[model samples]
Target: MKKPEVTEQPGGDPPSRRGRPPEPIGEDVGVAHRTWLEPVRDRLVASGLTLDELVCRSGYSKTRLSELLRGKGYYPGWEITYSVVKALDLPPWPLRRLWTAAAREADKNQGWIENRIRAVQPLGPELPPVAHLGLTQIMRGPYTAYARAFLQSENRAQRAVGETFDILWLTWDEAVAVPDTPRHAWQLLRARVMSRAAQQDGHPDLRQAAFATVAQAGIADLAERKTRIDTMADFFDAIARLPQDQMDVIVLRHLCGVRAEAVPGIVGLTPAMTHTLDHHARGALTGLYLRTGTTVTIDTLE
Candidate 1:
């Protein structure tokens, strides 16, 4: 096909433009995330620091940091995002809100809020032990926290935590070398943890009957244990309904217990992009939990 050509306007005015038209609004799901990040990136550039200097200060890989500043990724975690803010000594609250808005925009594009799923929760088996004591010890706290956050039963959560360590031990050397940033170890552990959790749990679903039973019970029947299970199930159900990318951010960062700085690489994003996705996912969950008028404290991106 022949390409369109510029031509003189009527009355000898300037020629009409011939280049491709601008992209349609809303075509790019990442636009909002990028828009909010670009200004901070420009400020970073104007500050006259070398890439190595930025890397040294931020503890992010050169490539990843550069990509994030260049607005290349769609999701960045809170840790990385905050690191940038801290590195540059910028105000926190405003940028934090902008980061949250960006994630909201991205999530809206992904149709996360409206999508619903009915699923049967799957339980994963415990992972076998392996070597790499240093790393294993490091992962224990966060991994246990993640398991407790995700699995309803205390025993299952403990087993899932063990499984996370087992998977990491299996490939400890390879994981250690990845990105080699301060947060890399945590990221690697989180990925394996989430992967294992997914494998164990086939699907997460809302058991309305359980809730209904609770609703009809006497005040004495509302034990702390039962309340915890109900809350955990509601969280898991919300997670199951999230869009894939948003869900990944939630699982890896919140459930699997990866640091915000470590989240981008684990989830295949730049730091700023990871922040956006993390914010959106958490915001969604928070809103869902709030509908019941219960105050919830999920992990922050930072």
Candidate 2:
């Protein structure tokens, strides 16, 4: 009789399909969790390690691993996650940061997060200096300024930039592979900033940001201040309605006070494209203001 062929899982473990396949992760799972969880599931599938074998390798029971793989029940702490990640020979830092983000999204308290993190061994080596000095430090200023426009808190803006850098470090290889590294990085930064932005009508609500504008601050009379704010609110609402590229150009060039030459680099667009976006954005804002009969001009926003 011919012998049944046996396949080996990673780490020289024999494959065993004793347990049922992991359940599909539902939409109910937060995006942050799904970001890391989906990759883990892909890795598991690629590894050809059954749930029973994974339990042996990760030192967790089949039930626990199954729940984690499916993203069911309470969010699993970092300790179990680290074990599985190591068992699968996957890099931990990127997934660690992602897990931390998911934990915060889950409203897991800092103490709980810290305790869970401590239960695992210290993370592997620090991010290389090339990633830090070459890209992160250079982009930090503009990224933070852009983030501050939406977040309104210096600490929150800094945190968002820091998280963006962490993600960049983890995905540096893929970032470099792309046609435009800065554009890829900008998208990541934008997502992080937007995730924390105040929402209005399902978009980032920038009307409150008008209160912080120098135009609003210069007004002394309460009646005049209210009028300016109301006008600025309408202007900002129109800004929110602008197409995304044009909106980004207006925000960076006018709102964030970044130089025209710098705006192109930051948004990863050519100088000509950036200028066109600015012109078109200004024109759109002008049209909106004309329709609304507002006296405020786009130049005044500068």
For model 1, what is the alpha-carbon lDDT of residue 279? Answer: 84
TM-score of 2: 0.82
Model 2, 1-302: lDDT tens digits are 11223455889887654334468997689977886787778667656677878899899998998889988999999999999988876678877888998999899999999999999889868555375458877899999999998898999898788878766665555578799989999998888888889888877888877889845468888898888888888788788778888988888878888989999889899999999999999888888778878878777777
Show the colliding residue pairs in model 2: none
C-alpha-based local distance difference test score of model 2: 0.82
Q: Global lDDT of each model?
A: 0.54, 0.82
- What are the clash counts of all predictions, listed in order? 13, 0
Taking the tens digit of each residue's C-alpha lDDT, what string does model 1 give over 1-302? Answer: 11224557889898763323222223343644644465565445445556676678888887777666655555565566666766765545445545655666656433432121112122134232333565556556655665454444567556555544443443344455576532545454444345434332454443332343344443365576488557655656667678766776776675555777866654457888778887888888788778888665464222
